[model samples]
Target: MIENIHFIAVALLIALGIYTLIFKRNLIKIAMGISILASGINLFLISLGYRAQGIAPIFTNAAIAASEVQAKMVLPAPQALTLTSIVISLAVTALMLSFAIIIYQKTGSLDATKSRRLKG
Candidate 1:
């Protein structure tokens, strides 16, 4: 029962992001939606690799052996991927925000309709 909450939250983030992307015309809001959507995907990846009461794969003490870790430790791949995704998301969000700033400067409005009119 408790484990389902993570998945539910992930769904909510993605749905809300899509809603914002579709309904909102503001450039900043759309960028935010993209960020939220990326976060949802990262969460989904993490949930896929989750294990109940699982420990790290690393061996800290001298007594622990590799065989024990193989059976009980959670996979580390998802965590590493999540970290990489976070860095990529940050860069993309920064780029999007910079573009939004440029658009706002040229059109004096963040609305998609105004930007489209300015383009043609």
Candidate 2:
């Protein structure tokens, strides 16, 4: 079970985020849920690139054999993707929160059901 701790954490984070997104009425809560979901995705991506006794992809040592370096070095692609994801999620979260703030200013409420678009 310990071997899959990261997977377990990812599942929990996703579940909580989904629950919040579906059941919460507040716009801020919804934004938090999205942020949590993004965090879980980032964790999953990082975990995917993990290796036991792994080293960075960078190789500064000239004496090490190429085969040994290849065997020990972790893949860089997932880390790069995760970094990009972080930047994107940060922007998305900022946008969501900013929109929420503007909506609250106009409506004086953060409840989604009370928003302009939802009322029929």
Question: Could you say which candidate leads in TM-score?
Answer: 2
Q: Give the C-alpha lDDT of model 1.
A: 0.90
Candidate 2 residue-wise lDDT, 67-105, digit = tens: 888788889999999999999999999999999999989
Query: Model 2 off-target regions past 4 Å?
Result: none
Q: What lDDT does each candidate get?
A: 0.90, 0.92
Q: What root-mean-square deviation over C-alphas does model 2 reach?
A: 1.5
Q: Write one digit per residue (lDDT tens) for candidate 1, span 61-117.
A: 724567777667889999999999999999999999999999888879999866786
Q: What's the residue-level lDDT of 87 in candidate 2? A: 100
Clashing pairs in 1: none
Clashes of 2: 0
